[model samples]
Every structure is written in structure tokens, then in C-alpha cells.
Target: MGLGKQDRTKAREELAHDQERAERLPELLRSVAEAERALDEARERGALVEEVHEQGVRLDTALTEAMRAAYARERVLVGVGGYTDRIRRRKRLARPEIKQATQVAEHLLTVREAHRLHGIQQAPRSVV
Candidate 1:
């Protein structure tokens, strides 16, 4: 009903997906291992050249998929409000930019001091 509840529901749904992937990861790993073994056996037997190539391709594809699933499982969120690992970009400032910023700041300070002095000069004086 509320935005906060919606956020929590989304987070829980994501966690459930991750958990499902994790549950299937073991089976995927086994499949990859079996494919590798089959490919090796085909190679050892000197089977048809096309068959060997096909087996090798299958093994490679399975291995890649299994690894991806494992990585996704490992990166799953831990808690409801925890932060996810993310890539951050560093802010780089050129020399010219830094110099211009410093000049602007100095100008602002000078203007502020001038305004303060002006205010002091304009204040009503006490009568003797």
C-alpha cells in the first residue's frame, strides 16, 4: 500500500530470485562437470572430429553459464536494507578548473566581507 512496503517487497522478491539461482547452482555445476568429462572421453577415443568439437563447445558453454550463476549467487544481497557492492567513479579535477574554483571562492569571501563592512557603517550610532 505504501512506498516503504513496496521497497521491502521488491527487495524480498530479489532475494527469492537469488535464492532460487543458488539452489539450482549445484545442478548446473554438475552438468558442467559431466559435459567436461564427456568431452574428454570423446577426445581420448579419437571420435569423429565434428563430435569432439561439438562436445568441447558444449562443455565451454556450460562452464561459462555455471560460473555466471555462481557469481550471481555470491553477490546476492544479505539483508533488507544492506548496501550492494557497486562501482564508483572518482572525481578528477583539472588544474585549470581547480584554479577557477579557487578564484571564485576568493571573490565570494571578498564580497561577503565588503557587505559586512557596509552593514557596520550603516548601523545607527548611539546618542550621547
Candidate 2:
């Protein structure tokens, strides 16, 4: 009923879709492999020309790309799920608490202007 719940549900749904895409990717790869094998066999038997094999190779490449795309979709879904978790954690943190926590040691430094302040540690960036 709430926005948070809705967001969480959407993220979960995306995650499920991503998992399904990941699972299907291997099957698509197998189909490409089978096509490649068939092309090779045809070439050996002289039933098909080089052009036929080339077409098969193109199809294989397309399928490989499709698999990559599917995997990427899955990653996006998983990232959404991670985003949902991050949002929940952020929601619980008070604004003032975050502001205080975000301050760096460098900001507190009463620098001895004459002396090189080498020992003061810097704050770790959120991304790092």
C-alpha cells in the first residue's frame, strides 16, 4: 500500500525477471553451438557451400550477442534489488546523523599553516 512497499515489490519483480533471463541465456548459447556444429557438418559433407557456413557464423554471433544482452538485463534487475536495499537503509538514517557522519577529518583540521600536516587521514569516499 505504501510507496516503499511498492518500490520493493517492483525491485523483486525485476530481480525475478533478471534471474529468468540469466537462466535462458545458456539455452540460447547452446542453440548457437548447435547451429555452428550443423554448419561444420554440412561443410564436411559438401552438402552446403562456404556461404552457408558464413551465414551460420553470423547467426551464431547474433545469438552470442543476444545472450550478452540477456545477461546485462539480469544485472540491471539485480542492481534494482540492491538499490531497494540501499533505499531502505538510507530511510532509517536521520538527516542530522548523516550530515555529522559525512563530515571528513580534513574538515576538522586546525592546520598548522607553517607545518606540513602529513598525518591527518582523509575521509573515505562513499564509492570507495
Candidate 2 per-residue C-alpha lDDT over 45-83 given as tens digits, one digit per residue, 9 for 90 to 100: 765344554645555454555445454443543355454
lDDT of 1: 0.54
* Model 1 Cα shift for residue 43 (angstroms): 0.7
Best by TM-score: 1
lDDT of 1 at 128: 100
In order of appearance, the predictions have TM-scores of 0.52, 0.40
**Model 2: what TM-score?**
0.40
Model 1, C-alpha of 110: deviation from truth (Å)? 59
* Candidate 2 clashing pairs, residues 3+ apart or interchain: none
| Tens-place lDDT digits, model 1, residues 17-126 | 76677566678778867986887888788777667767766665665556555544543423333222122111212245434544433543453355344311222344
RMSD of 2: 21.6
